[model samples]
Target: CSNGGLEGANNGKITVPAGVTSFTITTPTVDDDLKEDTEAYSISVGGVDATGTILDNEEDIEVSSVTSDTQTEGTSLVHTVTLSGEAEAAKEYDFTFNNGTVEDEDIGTLQFSNGVTYDASTGKITVPAGVTSFTITTPTVDDDLKEDTEAYSISVGGVD
Candidate 1:
């Protein structure tokens, strides 16, 4: 009950003594299971003001470890990739950069340079640990003949 406690409505209630003005809640910083990354929720304290008055501002509960942002599809997408968190020892993280939708399966015709090469066998890139960021190069393609800019994404969850 102490660890992994949910303060959401119908789940649990946060109460403070009559003299107390505010209270603090605990949250997990990291997890061993990869599935437990991050979570967030909005909380609204509603009741009699005799006990404590909740703030008028929007309150949010954020539980997170790793996160990602959407990348636009383009003829040339040179992304400076940065992994999450810091590493104490030198190691490697296996990851993947997915191109197009699953139904379409279009990885585009753009070419990559330097150490950025696609591996169809393992379907992941071996990134050395302790390295926060690295460059991924892609040559521009002639989009005049193409219909539109396709979709693609990058992921780091495959890393063990």
Candidate 2:
């Protein structure tokens, strides 16, 4: 008794036509357990217009079972870095990262992109899924001998 129940059959359902009034149903970011009692999912909508009219709207997708307060993202999450001098052996060095507050960076550094990845043993740096912000391209070690300006420090602990 389900063709697109809970919007999970490959997530293929959402057609708007016949005057195009309005439509918007987007829900993402689900990770909060400790359920004491509260969880629901039911957004039924069968449509038909442009001569053959019929639109059913029985919406309801409430999920609120607090107890954990939502804070679980520690799959070995790591992004530690530190460097402030020592690079003048072969040349080729350029440091750029700040985090004054974010949105431009200045405090320590952090303004990543959409698809990120950096794991040198476990210094995890994977902010996948429509990344919000990320930027840490540490690569260019020449160590020739002629250094003077070196600086870097990125530390983002796991969110338990």
Candidate 3:
């Protein structure tokens, strides 16, 4: 009965009141920070077994920009991404970089830090476990053409 993160006394005698055909049984559980799937277990009483589930309470992965300062051409636009909580395991996040007003050639090579990698085929970023924060730097090309100020964006998509 202790399977699936369920903890507490496995067996105990409960005294049902006279003329009472029903009663309530409370099962204690252990709290953890790991993000896990739903767990299940069963309890038997008076030759009857009842099933129960332990719902996961861990928070989902969240991404927020820690820094997004404007950079001049020939420099880099730095973006720091942070998670809501520490990762229990390696997680992959899908992201996209869009050149709003700038051409594709205006953007330079993308760089990632804090043990993260960008998969060109999948367009996803793999963040290693125990990493709560990382940075992405996008360099801008310095061209001789005199054009208006251009804009770009980095967006986070699905997380797995």
Candidate 4:
């Protein structure tokens, strides 16, 4: 009997004819961004048998192997996170950023009640006070500042 006609067997049991060899299962691409390392994501691959049967218990596969393209860098007031990786095609992925801190050098002294604004467009920091030395540890990107970090100097008599 041919491969297709085997399903019509009277006993509901069919024997395979010799020469039919191997089948392959293709893995789908996954894109994910995790804020913490312990996060898990599920991936599914279609094209299963008519009965939705999967070989080797391989249904609803778990994702493995994640890589990050960039890291967060800046002072205490702001930080930036750049990321890239392989994700499933035509699918949307959500990447979470955990609150983390980085080391920043003191450019000038930051006085109490002084205002500081980070410009995302030019990647520069504006301070409203004259600081002898100030360390920016957790700088974040804003609409004015695009890059991760910026440079600025403080004058003793600068206007607040």
Candidate 5:
């Protein structure tokens, strides 16, 4: 009646009544928000052992957030995309520039680090291993058509 010495589980002692054939042990699931491989643990009773495996349910690349302040017209609107967890491999993502109050031409070529670049023609970016954050820069056109402040957003899409 032990917890198999697992970190996410609790240790316990169970009393088995005479003539009881079997009992149940509960293994609690832990949400660590980290991508990991399957982990195994063993439960021993009277020199006999039983093994159990915990499957990782977390995403390879955690959710991403765009961090940037309001930009002045004619300056590059730099959006820094950040991932939450450390990646074991390169993480590829697709993003799109959504127009709110700006025109399509207002967005320029998107530039990234490590020689990675994309424009309106392509919609993908790859974050290399051991990298958690990267920036994408695109110039905003300062048009003569004077209106209110233009609002736009870069929408990060599916992961690969």
Candidate 6:
């Protein structure tokens, strides 16, 4: 997980072991004042301690492609990370982020911004502008048995 207390900071690299098939990375949502810009942050994943070469050859997972839309000025974004390879079932992986910073804080929390919308049908929260980030810490179980229970704990940082 990245973007918690340390915004615009880098924590360095995380090592994933071999035989692991999938993993999830969590990033904290940011709440910030609207007047600021140029929030700098970065999250990187690497296979430093793996028994075999990391497949894909990509240095780190690209979060921008998966959750770019959610990083808007005043909205909370949730993104799920999954591996794309064949390995043992139920294997686990861990990812860590390089420290960084977000410029705005007042815009992060829902109460201060335009508010959020929950779509039961799509299972998504729509955040408005001026907010740096939003995260769902706990997710209610879906009506369908096929869905898994999910929870999120997020924090946003900026000028109050």
lDDT of 5: 0.67
The CA lDDT of each predicted structure is 0.42, 0.33, 0.77, 0.30, 0.67, 0.32
Per-residue CA lDDT of candidate 3, range 1-160, in tens? 3223333444365444456666566678889887656789997777999999998798876775455669888898888888877766788888887778989888888999988898989988898888889888998999998888998777764321
lDDT of 6: 0.32
lDDT of 6 by residue, 1-160 (tens): 3323323234464444555555655545444322222344544445333222222222321112222223422334443322232222122222222112332321332222224455446534444433333333221222323322222333221111
lDDT of each residue in 1-160, candidate 5, tens digit only = 2323323224444445566666556678787755666789988755778999998886667546877558887898777777888665666667776677887777676678654445446666666676777777878777777768878767664321
Looking at model 4, report the run of 10 residues with the lowest lDDT sum: 86-95
Predicted structure 2, TM vs. truth? 0.20
Question: What TM-score goes with each of the models?
Answer: 0.36, 0.20, 0.64, 0.17, 0.54, 0.20
Leading candidate by TM-score: 3
Give lDDT: candidate 4, residue 111.
Answer: 24
For model 2 the local lDDT of residue 138 reads 32
Best by lDDT: 3
Residue-level lDDT tens digits of model 4 in 1-160 = 3444234344544444457453232334333442212233333223324222222221222222222223243222422221132222221122222333322332222222223344446534443323222223323333433454444322111111
lDDT of 2 by residue, 1-160 (tens): 1222233334556544455555545444344321122334455556433222222232221211111111112111123222222221211112223322222221222333344554546655554432223334333333344544443444443121
How many residue pairs collide in each prediction?
Answer: 2, 20, 0, 29, 0, 28
- Candidate 3 matches the true fold with a TM-score of 0.64
Model 2 ranges with Cα > 4 A deviation = 1-40, 43-96, 99-126, 129-137, 141-145, 155-160
Candidate 2: what lDDT? 0.33
For model 4, state the Cα shift of residue 108 in Å: 27
lDDT of 4 at 123: 38
Please provide, for model 1 over 128-155, each residue's C-alpha lDDT reduced to its tens digit, 9 standing for 90 to 100.
3344455555434443344554555555
Q: Which residue pairs in model 3 clash with each other? A: none
